[model samples]
Target: MTKDWLTTGETAKMLGVSRQHVVDLCTRGELTFSQPGTHRRIRSSEVQRLATSEFTREQEKSLWLHRALLGPLMLDPARVLQIATENIARWKPLQRGDGMATRYLEQWDEVIESGVDAVADVFTSKDERSSELRQNTPFAGVLDDDERRQVLQSFREHRQREHAAV
Candidate 1:
């Protein structure tokens, strides 16, 4: 039988993020892990659940771009959350009949209320709910145009290099 737990590296590979990101998830209490000896061991089941929420290439690209907000989110979450809160309020009506999308938006509010760590989790999580909430993101103006442009350009360059290497 397959082992029921995974190493940080294994979890990262499954989530398409760095091992350190997996550690961060544990630190944020998003994923529970056991410390055996010196390494962190996460439940394989939890990792699989996250993996199942797989984003399309475009969604992954968007998420990668959003990683740029990690710093700002950590540094001044209050301002970032204020913008997101306003965005959510404004867009609620726009969602009209898209219940799933609206529900995600409401969830975003809860994540926002939960504080910085929770919001950060949403930005980095591979969970299906997180992915859905990302589509209805309330962070419309968190990043300035220059920061957004830089992140987009960097993502483009990275994708080009990835293709070239392949």
Candidate 2:
């Protein structure tokens, strides 16, 4: 069976922190870990939770934006659209005052309401076009291009793993 628990080093890598930090978190009971035969092992779920919780509000918003934009490509289209809609709604207020951003969100709302084909069209668009879409998104000003790319790549990898398990 695949191991579901991560060693301190592995957990540190996932959390982008040092091994000692992971140990400190475990010692402080901030992150759950178990000592099995003198080695501390953290559940992968705990690592994910910690990583997510560590994100700044802007990072979280960017994450949700990536999920909304890329999720339908790999998962149930309708479900992804619903998630995207909720994400957009949640961030809309914070995203006000930018005309391009407002227009982009409106476009997403229209596409989501237009049904599955519109969502698919977005997923199937050329890379250049997709990049353009990302540029116009609310997250564009929040996350730098490299950060956005990293977030999208990470989400894609996660979705691939999830699909492989299914």
Count of clashing residue pairs in every prediction: 0, 0
The residue ranges of model 1 lying beyond 4 angstroms of the native Cα positions read: 1-55
lDDT by residue for model 1 (1-166), tens: 1489889988888886656657766876767889979888999988876567544545576687568888888898788889999988888888856555577678888998999988888898877566656756889788889988998888889878976896
Give Cα-based local distance difference scores for all models: 0.78, 0.63
Clashing pairs in 2: none
Top candidate on lDDT is 1
Q: Write the per-residue lDDT of candidate 2 for residues 44-77, one digit (tens) a residue.
A: 9999887766443333333445555554345665
Candidate 2 accuracy as lDDT? 0.63
